[model samples]
Target: MTQTCLVTGGAGFIGCAISDALTAAFDTVVAVDNLHPQIHKTGARPAALNERVELIVADVTEPGTWDEVLAKHRPDTVIHLAAETGTGQSLTEATRHAQVNVVGTTRMLDALAARGIVPQRIVLSSSRAVYGEGEWLDAQGKGHYPGQRSAQMLEQGQWDFPGLRSQPFRCAHTKPAPTSVYGATKLAQEHILSAWCLAFGTGLNILRLQNVYGPGQSLTNPYTGIVSLFARMAKAGKSIPLYEDGHMLRDFVFIDDVAAAIVAAATSDKSGILADIGTGDSLSIAQLASVIGDIYQAPPPHVTGQFRNGDVRHAACDVSATRDTLGWTPQVDAATGARRLCEWIDQRPEQLERL
Candidate 1:
């Protein structure tokens, strides 16, 4: 029996990496992607995509596209990674984010339902944005999920949530209170899939991923993934800009570890399970700039004091449950991952040409 796993958005950074991991487990792997021009500048198949994977160029938002694809290849597992990302971009392009992240997910579920196709499991690549300010700890060490920061507070250079000292934990226990449009749509994806899977008796696994960065990340996107952005600036002989006093915290998980987590979810027998995927640690944004500067031999990062609306103050997810359930652990640390990323970036100077 030939086992097949279909991955949406399977040609991009994380998708391509996930496709590579999936090929070793599933006999056949099919990738469905729109090949968005923002990521795939030529609107063609990415060279980084694994040669063994089959690529279907189509948007997930289109019902007909799903109908045809589902009828042809009923995969044993569906890993949904096709969605618009970025906190700053989502604020201005709310409809685009909602259409792709929320509507696209529902469209795929509707197609599966129409075809009476229930895959062995469906793995959703969710985001930590769903937790908003996430799980913060006050002076007394009491956990609290803060609301969206006001523009006045941001303009006053107030970065973190007042009286809070910590970030969110695992997704299974935290209640989602998304602050950005991107986060709202992601939470919507989880709800839609949960309802569908419940009615269909299909297994569902959701991984609320934190900041993921590595080799294939889009250096030109200009909207998300600050690691790639900072790397591009450093390559261009420019100083990295540190926003919000350079003290904002984030958990930068390596791409390989994230791919492994997704693969674990796809292969696991868990149903209605939610887990957070990250390094289980946190670092200040200024610290991230120092790492990039050291690797690129660029100028020191400057404290810009600029801030973006809809951006969370801190984001670090605990992966204890993920480790226990999926039997996965992060192998690469931030420093080592940055070194490896720079090596890969050096080989592709064309990516830095526009910088």
Candidate 2:
């Protein structure tokens, strides 16, 4: 039988890429999205989405959204990409985060179990957020996992907290130590899905993705995607807003690379496997801002004393397991990806006006 696949958040940045790839593999693909106005105001289908896939405008938080859809489609594969994003916003909108991320995921799994149809495979778009603070090391070169950054510590700009001469250590696929509301909920989503899938014998692939950025990301949203924000500001002839010392590190994986990894996991008959989907690379926030400025020929970002509470000091993805298991690796280098993103913004000058 020809297989059917369903993707939630199907029109967003990563969602669009995944949907496009799935269309090439599956006979039919359907997407469900509520089209949050902050990220997507068009209300119309995204121009880049494949025409073959059907789109249902619905809220994942509402029960019937999945209940009715799942009953009708009975999709062979389900790629759950829908979730509330952002560390800062998640702190402020705690309830909404729980509703959309935690409760929403529970509803999806609940609906699937209600139907008593174990999907051939289910892939949940997990996040690097789950690993709140990156692994840490001390003066003795021993390992450590620091808790949330304190307000006083961040306020005085005492960035590093040494636990008996301990400092930030680098590691990947380490047990998640989520530091924010968003991180907590994402971790919860993973736990919920893993337990449910195991109990029901549904094949599961968890992609612990790193910071994903690319062309389709929202330019106007202030709460997520530093790359998108920088590009948008540059287009408007504004100075990039630098936070902290601009030394906080992160692993930025391109959207196309992430989409390919998700498809590789979702379609594969592989079960009970979790992989770190990243470049195993790291870059500082200041460096990223400077590069984006170079792309637009804009002014260099100014470093401010401001610091985000839940932001990590540094993080780099470990893609060894990802390559070993799925035989997948990130293909797009950061420079090329940044150029493509800047070009995308230039192509849609009107969207820049929305900034």
**Candidate 2 residues 1-355, lDDT tens each?**
8899999888787878877678989998989999898888778888778888898889898998987688679888988899999899888899999999999888888888888878888898988888877667677777677777899989989777665332222234376888999989988998999898889888888888888999888887788888888888776677898788888877888999998999999877677768887778777888888888887788888989799878877767777767878879899977788889888878988877655
Q: Give residue 317's error in model 2 in angstroms.
A: 1.2
- Over 1-355, each residue of candidate 1 has an lDDT whose tens digit, in order, gives 9998999988888888887778889999999999888888878787778889999999999998897798789888999999999898999999999999988998998888888888889999999999988677788888876688899999998777667776556766777888899999999999999988888888999989989999888877878778877777887778999998998888889999999889989988776778889998888899988998988789999998999999988888888888887888998888888888888888987757765
Going through the candidates in the order shown, the clash numbers are 1, 3
| Candidate 2 residue 36 C-alpha distance from true site, Å | 1.3
lDDT of 1 at 230: 78
Provide TM-scores for the models. 0.97, 0.95
Best by the TM-score measure: 1
Model 2 CA deviation exceeding 4 Å by range = 163-173
Q: Pick by lDDT: which candidate is best? A: 1
